[model samples]
Target: MDWGSIFSNAMASALGPDAIVYALAAIGLNVHFGYTGLLNFGQAGFMAVAAYGLAASVATWGLPFWVGIAIGFGAALLLALLLGVPTLRLRADYLAIATIASAEILRLVFGSVTLSDWFGGSNGRQQFANTFYDMNPYSSRLDFGLFSFSANDAWVFTVGWFLVALSCLAVWSLMRSPWGRVLKSIREDEDAVRSLGKNVFSYKMQALILGGMFGALAGFMLAIKQQSVIPTDYATDITFFAYTALLLGGAGRVLGPVIGAIIFWFLMTFLGGFFSSAASIDLIPDVVMSDIQASLVRFILVGAGLMALMIFRPQGIFGDRREIAIDGR
Candidate 1:
């Protein structure tokens, strides 16, 4: 098994845009579920709204880059309100039901052939990122000991990492403020926070809108990173992946998603390479696995491992047990 290749691929995923993208999304989720205890199963819906906002703005309206960004964010905020208004005060399960349904509805709408003319329907959109790329600062390639990045990728990395840093800092600062305490309190017991005179519903709305916007921002980055926006790309599976990254690194911590994304992608890529190489050499018989089965097998293994982690070490690597423990009574 080419150990060097395995390491390189693992490192690439760990340090690359995939990791950063998930980290950004998970950070937003950390706000929704981690600190606020809001089970927003429709985070992907939020992202979709933002992605299409940018895509439609430029492709249909010939808008500038900043205008597209504002449209995306505005669209996310609108979705958050629409999702939260009817369900925020209903109860946890209601919020989940409403969000999940809303997410699917948005997906269906985007994929509907009726709006294909403006939204691009099943085909999606591209070639709408001239403005974002115009701001790239790096003029040449950047290299560091066995790793390097082309200038465009460097701009993405630079911008993505900066967003991650800013998001984390925002999370850290918010968690330290009075509003943050209220959010944590709501997570523990909304009734208790309500008794203390905090508008529990409003706080949750704020958290949802804020986190959903961050998810939308992540969607924007993802679309711009590839210069495309497709409905299927922001499916519920992506939301689950963001959740996986959040949990793997331990939720409720500012940097948990960042660490979780690194670890998740590293393990996923490295294990895939290792298993494929082992199969190529017949180290593992076809009875056990094959190269063709590697992709599915790695996820199965990770899922089992995560199941075990939840059973034994529920708080994750950097998480404090007190942080994740629920006293939902």
Candidate 2:
């Protein structure tokens, strides 16, 4: 097996656009599940709407790129209001059910034949990100020792990392404020916070809107990086994966999502590269594992790793045990 190649690929993935995308999404999830205890399982829905918002605004309506961005953010804000108002007052589990269901519903609607004219149905939308790429400052590929990036990818990396940094700073600042303290207190016990004459519903809505905006940022990153917005790309698994990243990094902590995203992508890429290389060399018997099967082993291993983490260290690398204790009431 080519160990050097595998290691390089893993390194590249650790810092690539995929890591940035998940990091932003996980940061949003951390705000919801980690800090506020919101149980927002529809994060993918937020991302989808924002992505489609931008795609439709530019590709279908011939709007400017910046206008598309504003529309995407607006769409995310609308989604948060729509989801939070109806279910934030209910039990956390209800919020979870509502979010997950709504995410799936939105995905189906975006892909529906009836909406093809606007959303491109199952095919999705492209040709909407040229404006973003046209602003690239890097005229040539950026070559690092371990991996290299095309000029386009280099521009994305710069923008994506900047966004991640800005989001982290915002979360850090917010969590240290009085409002942030209340959110933590509410997470520990909403009834107690409510007894203090605080408007729990209002705070919850604010957190939802803030977190959904972060999700929208992630959506923008993805749409720009891929130069397309496909409904299928916003599946429920996307939200779960972001959750996994948040859990791995430790929820409620500002840097947890970012760290978790880097590690998650590193491990995933390393395992994938290792398996693919081994299979190419027939290190494992064909009957035991084919090239196709090699690609799947990484997910199985990661899943088992996640289960172990939940069992042995539910608080994650940087999370406190108390942070995971949600006040379901």
Candidate 3:
């Protein structure tokens, strides 16, 4: 079954750009869902707007990359305000619905024919990452036995992982502060926090903005990795996968999402490659599952695995049961 190649490829995928992107996204989700008790089901929307912000600013308006970065953060902040002002005081599910709906609406609008000129209407934007790659220090490919990457990917990884480290450090530091404790207290019981004279809504909005900024950074990393932006790239499915990563790693723990992202991609690519190799060697009947089916079966297996985890250990690999016991109310 060519286990060597399968394992090698899986390892590579674990450390690849996709893993970095999702790790950042899941980190943002951890802040929203794990720490703050926010049901932000539209994290992908944050990522989308950020990506388009950079793309449109650079490709359409001929702005510099740094300007694009500013625009991206602005868009994310605006989106957070738009979503939080009317919904933060409502039920948790209301925020979920609003975020998910806003994300879908934004995706459709970006791809709409009327906005094709600005957003490129489905094909997305390209050639916007030159500035990032131009700063690469490596002149040759990096081969690390089980994994290898191009010079460009090396640059992306260097910047992306650095950002991830900074995000984790920020989360770690913030969660230890008095404000961070208040956030957790609010998560456990908002009414109590409110009674104690803390402005619950304000804290929630701050967390939203903070987390959305993290998501925007992920979007920037992703856009730079692909050197382009597409509406479909930020689909709701991305948010779900990120959530899966958060749950797998143990949400609310500073490193949970990061570890979860690594493990999730590792298992996914490993199982996928293993199944494809087995099918190629005629160990599995074609009628039972084709090559395409082999590729997709991993997600089914992963889904079942997640269900098992939720049933047996809902707190996840690193989560404390008491921490997640907080009422969403």
Candidate 4:
């Protein structure tokens, strides 16, 4: 196992487009679950809709990439409104249930055979990113000795990071204002905010829609990054991973999810490569572990780490304990 290669790849993964994608998604989630205490269990649903929205728009409707972007955001905003209006008035778990159910429903609907002509069904849609790649300024591949990326990936990384920065800056600015204070107040006690004559429901709707739009941006980046949109890629696991990023970085804080996404991807890829390499070449006897064992080891390690994080430091690396203690509804 080439340690240098493993380390370089791991670092590249941390700093590459994958990190940017997850960071964008996690940041949006921070707005939802972290600050607003929305318990939005279907973040991937928003991402899926946005991704497919872009792909379908361009592939079937002959729309421009920018139009697809708008469509994606519009779909996510609608999803947020649809999910929030019905469930936000209820307890936290109800929002969670509705979100998760809605996400799965969207996935199943997108995968339906009836929509295959347009959505490509289970195979998903592609060729929606040609216009995006056509905007690339760099004609040659980019390399920094330790790692390298194709011209296409570099363009994706550049745009993706830009979106992440914009989203973070937006969150930072908003969280410092009176409006942000209202959100925190609602998280602490909606009843208290209501008593103060604040329109709690409106605030909740705004939070949901904004967060969902952020998720939509992430989905847009993901769609262009991969140059494709597959329904399976936006599974519930993506939501779990994004949540891990939020928990790892700390919720409610502007920079938590970005830091969490980088670290989470780094450790995950690094440990996975390390353990897999060690298990190979008979470093570990088959009795103790086989090649197949290496595959499951990373998930177990990452899961245990997440468990430890929740148990010992629920507030995350950047979050104070108070940040995690939302209204106990």
Q: Candidate 2 lDDT, tens digit per residue, 248-309?
A: 99998999999999999999999998887788789977889898899789999999999999
lDDT of 3 by residue, 177-294 (tens): 9988988888788999999999999999999999999999989998999899998998999999999999999988999999999999999999999888778777887988888778
Per-residue CA lDDT of model 4 for 130-165, tens digit only, reads 988998998998887988888999888788888899
What's the lDDT of the predicted structure labeled candidate 2?
0.93
Highest lDDT model number: 2
Model 2's TM-score against the true structure: 0.97
Error of 4 at 219 (Å): 1.1
For each candidate in turn, give its C-alpha RMSD to the true structure in angstroms. 1.8, 1.9, 1.6, 1.9
lDDT of 1: 0.87
| Model 4: lDDT of residue 315 | 84
TM-score of each: 0.95, 0.97, 0.97, 0.96
Better of 1 and 4 by TM-score: 4
* Candidate ranking (TM-score, best to worst): 3, 2, 4, 1
Q: How accurate is candidate 4 locally (lDDT)?
A: 0.88
lDDT score, candidate 3: 0.92
Over 4 Å off in model 1, which ranges? Answer: 286-288, 323-329
| Residue ranges of candidate 4 with Cα displaced over 4 Å | 321-329
Clashes of each: 0, 0, 0, 0
